[model samples]
Target: MRYKGTKAGAIVVAAVTGSVVLAGCGDGSGSQVEGGGASPSASRSADAQEQGTTEVRAAYEKTAEAESARMTIKMNLAAAGKRITSDGEGVLDLATGDSVMTITAQDKTIEQRVVDQVLYQKVPGQNAPSGKPWIKIDLEKVAGQQGLSNQQIGDPAQTAAYAKAITDKDVTKVGTENVGGVSTTHYKVSVDVSKLPGGEQMSQQLGPTLPMQVWLDDEGRLRRQQIDLTVKAPASASAKPEGSASAQQLKMSTVMQFSDFGTEVNAEAPPADQVADMTDKALQGSRQQS
Candidate 1:
């Protein structure tokens, strides 16, 4: 039980701090600017392409400028023939980079809090040698080591950074749709992962291009976004050979929805006495358990 808890804690930190971000290709169903005869209809398609590029860029800017918001997230991950689903709701203070979230998975609930750019995760009290209920991680130090900017660490959805992946030629206006009871414009774009901020490491695992869908409300703010990706599971010596029929695949899907913009969010850190830092001593213990 101790080993399992420690390993799980390590996995959570790696998953969040790593550069393996959202990726995969979206189905683009819009005009082609290449190999076109100079027809009047083709000219209109070019104009529409320009319009899509503008709209997506505008949405990115608007979302970045938001003060705060209430958000819900759903994530499904499948690997090694096992599937797990998790749901979370949170309030984010964009201005202060503070937030609180509660996530539930497999009948277990975990609470996460971020205040002043530091992250705290509630864990089983027995897992901590000091009997603390919360594990503290210095997000600023970790983000710096990972070469992530302050904005990247604060933006849980990475919505702004993801929008930077799409090029003008890759965006296609898919039409209008209702999201969360609000009318929104749907757009599909194949993300060039190489263009994403801090994307150098992720592009290798997720491939160079991936698909993403975004919905923008009337004010050009991001109402919802989704990413789906399937990647080959890393092979082990005892497991089936790579690319063989028995090889495994990992499929991950994530969706984030935003509402109640400019809401006040309070995300205070746990008291010092009840917090244990994820330091060298804890890491050494985890290594031994593995």
Candidate 2:
């Protein structure tokens, strides 16, 4: 199996969701906003000044915090003339810089923990041996179950790295829009992904450049963001590389939706009593194997 299934698994677990604004520096002859002969950069600076960087940053922080709370994400994957729908709830731990997601479908349950740039999936009946640096989660086996490889989960440090990428760039007010019935300010930010520390890695994952339109509420929380992701996959890889005639080109448009703010429930710690049952199950399964 090609392992495209890993995408779905990772999406289910680590929906923990960037920042920055950049200015178009190519030409000084760009269209002016309200002021005469003003570049896009000038316009953005004016807006930020009107809002005050301190206030804007505060708003961004509040929104970021709110967004990190309880969220229900619905993922729909369409491929090979088949569509699969998965629903999951996630709690973002800003303190530990991690996200815990639990998703259940039919009789299968998957609990995923994304921490320190690694994604771990614990199946209902399988227990990994303790103290492993990282256990490779077989995404193929967990296609409809739950799992993620290190590469697919992404690095947490990259998140902060990307945030700093466009810190000095300008943010233009793109007007107001309503999301989930909440009025929000839309900002058009131009960020150079190649400038950040992990920019190369993110660019590889997203392919080339990434342009995003971010929406924020009056409180400065991110309501939604839309990025046009263009990924180039080889033809043979896109199809099924038989006899290696080079990879085919494949393109997909991904729209990631975020919603249900301020709904994060408190983290439910695992019960101490449950450990004995899990250990017994693991031992029993191991004996059966022997």
Highest TM-score: give the candidate number. Answer: 1
| lDDT digits (tens) for residues 1-290 of candidate 1 | 44334333333333322221232111122232222223244778877766666566556446546767887877777655557777878987655556788877666787878677666777443446667887776665543433344434444355445545655666778999998999999888676767776566546445777767778899877788776766443232224555576554546676778899887798898889888887444444333422
Per-prediction TM-score: 0.70, 0.52
lDDT of 1 at 10: 31
lDDT tens readout by residue for model 2, 168-240: 2334567789977889877655455565554565454445555666666776665665544333332212344
Q: Which consecutive 10 residues in model 2 have the weakest lDDT in total?
A: 20-29
Q: Once superposed on the true structure, which residue ranges of model 1 sit more than 4 Å away at CA?
A: 1-41, 79-81, 123-129, 138-164, 197-200, 229-251, 279-290
lDDT value for model 1: 0.60
Clashes of 2: 9
Question: What TM-score number comes out for model 1?
Answer: 0.70
RMSD, every candidate, angstroms: 6.7, 10.2
Score residue 229 of candidate 2 by CA lDDT.
Answer: 35
Clash pairs, candidate 2, are: 63-221, 70-264, 234-247, 234-248, 235-247, 235-248, 235-249, 236-247, 236-248
